[model samples]
Target chain A: MYLLLDQPTISQSSGNVVDGINLEDIKEFAKAFKLRRLGLGLTQTQVGQALSVTEGPAYSQSAICSALASQMLAAQLSSQQQNIFEKLDITPKSAQKIKPVLERWMKEAEERYASGQNHLTDFIGMEPSKKRKRRTSFTPQALELLNAHFERNTHPSGTEITGLAHQLGYEREVIRIWFCNKRQALKNTVRMMSKGMV
Target chain B: MYLLLDQPTISQSSGNVVDGINLEDIKEFAKAFKLRRLGLGLTQTQVGQALSVTEGPAYSQSAICSALASQMLAAQLSSQQQNIFEKLDITPKSAQKIKPVLERWMKEAEERYASGQNHLTDFIGMEPSKKRKRRTSFTPQALELLNAHFERNTHPSGTEITGLAHQLGYEREVIRIWFCNKRQALKNTVRMMSKGMV
Candidate 1:
């Protein structure tokens, strides 16, 4: 399902399209999402901050921008590329991922505004986020060991993960997630290298 | 920021409006998301199937539909409620959540199509999803006990949760998640009651 969208276009908006994806639809959504964000009187930075403190993992402004639009290669685009979807800097998949989070947040914010509670605190739930474990700051030495373990084998058994957790004074689940994220990171890195961008 | 958007409108589309959310934008995007999905020759059912087998939690057909449109009460709409934005049934927050997951899956599927690997197998990814954990089916006795505990205290300390896990022979995390989901369900139920639906 991984479509290598980094490459420039081959000009086939019709007939046996690559990925069977409708670029036109993706383009429209991206433009609309941006407009909606603006209409909410919220900036990308503000959305980014609000999302980070809510629930789930934090997303950066760059991530948000990528979901909405990517920087297309100048050669491929027209001199006056007004539409965000003209070149489709961002992929359809990334946009799909981000749209809902932004949508829901904006809706909630608007509701608060409508109710006459136009405060940022009211937008982000007043109750602090549930205590999902605090962000673990891995020391250099710990990272080295973890990296070495990962290099040896990405998929460590529960027992092995538990042993490592005991040794490093971290939770077993944390170590497990670390391995998962590390493998994902490695996979992304390898993919980048293959694309000759590394 | 929980914004109850079920009520009738306050009507302030211009000039420093509260509830600054643009339903028009959300409606357009929802329509666009559907078109893109159709262009890819994928059904909502197919997408739901594909999402279930993937990394994240499974999404239902209702979830998919709600992402695009929800069943709004007749009273909520005007006589000529042609536009989807007229008293949106689905909340923006929920739509935001589902968008990215769908977007990502569709892109992957389209990529598969472009590469001439236009099969469900190819679209769902080559390797099987990593086995994180299976869904636990709690016994009737366990459910009764758990419900009893929940009635007493909606919030259980980690130690208490661990104790329950050991007592019920279930994973601590599963028990914790159950509590979280239960609380959410309860909150949703309360909201529905407030809206005079139940």
Candidate 2:
């Protein structure tokens, strides 16, 4: 079901209301939620991590233990999760779906705070049991080669990327992402220069 | 010289001062410049466009007329020019290099404003004579095919991108950028989901 939601759509017409919920009300709620979250001295990351544990199905014990094994992955994953509020407002339907869960969580957190359970972890949950692959850093030589290829052709085939990866001694996935980032950088530069030119 | 400035450098050590100019002063100036720009009811784009005309060499009359030919390109280029302030303070040396130009331009603007020459164009120069390629919007079928390819292999070589472009009846460049944006979107989704998992 979640995977279905993840499928890309070119556009989602955001009407004034969705699922009998007013867009205006959701916008107001979003603003208020941000203020309330800040007032509690909690970050979006903390809320996201906490909500996963409390609202979702528990991962198996083995999965939880695996998450605990890599502190670096935990930190990386936590950084990635820090923008839940922004994500919620992407579409009216999504905002409507997430509102109730957030409202309930915020209320529980406030109640705990009032009752003197001030430690953030007390309400937010134990440390997140999530892991992520480490960031890839390319060598300068590899970057030069990649840039040379990009200058010639912005897109490379799966096989070509695999070949480059093998030649550069990096993961094929890393090489692929590098191309994507490189293209983005080129687009941005052109955009910036066009600004000056225009 | 400008090209040299654009060279990729892994790191630039920003100290408290550079070339007898204080970093603190530059930071304060950046803040003030933003405020002053706002006070003039000016956007960063307007300033960037204005600066290109006023501070740099005239981009040949032919180039300016070429820019005038395409209104769509002009609008696109204008949007890209926005965010000059953020770009200024990337490094202390860069900030110092640009500070004088911005300061002089602001002073001239203020003088013009005080004298009742308040029309933005009077100081900001004529509309930017810049052009950019039109944005590409992919069909649903194209996107579906692209996503399928991405799932199998995020990187597609030049030949594959050209083939897809021909198959879809779109420009090869557009198809390549589609792959790039798709990859970025996937990375962002993974990051967002990781936040939830953590």
Candidate 1 segments whose C-alpha is farther than 4 A from its true place: A1-198, B1-108, B111-126, B129-135
Tens-place lDDT digits, model 1, residues B56-140: 4455565455434431121122323323222223233333344355456666666676676545565653344345577789898
What is the CAPRI rating of model 1's predicted complex?
Answer: incorrect
Provide TM-scores for the models. Answer: 0.27, 0.33
How high a TM-score does candidate 1 get? 0.27
lDDT of 1 at A33: 51
What is the TM-score of candidate 2?
Answer: 0.33
lDDT of the structure predicted as candidate 2: 0.52
Judge candidate 2 at residue B93 and give its lDDT.
41
- Predicted model 2 interface RMSD: 14.9
Candidate 2 lDDT over B1-198, as tens digits, reads: 122112232223344444444544544554566677778777665766576677564444333223222222212222223232233222334435554555677777876776775555667876543457888777777777875565334556578899999999999888888877755654454344345432
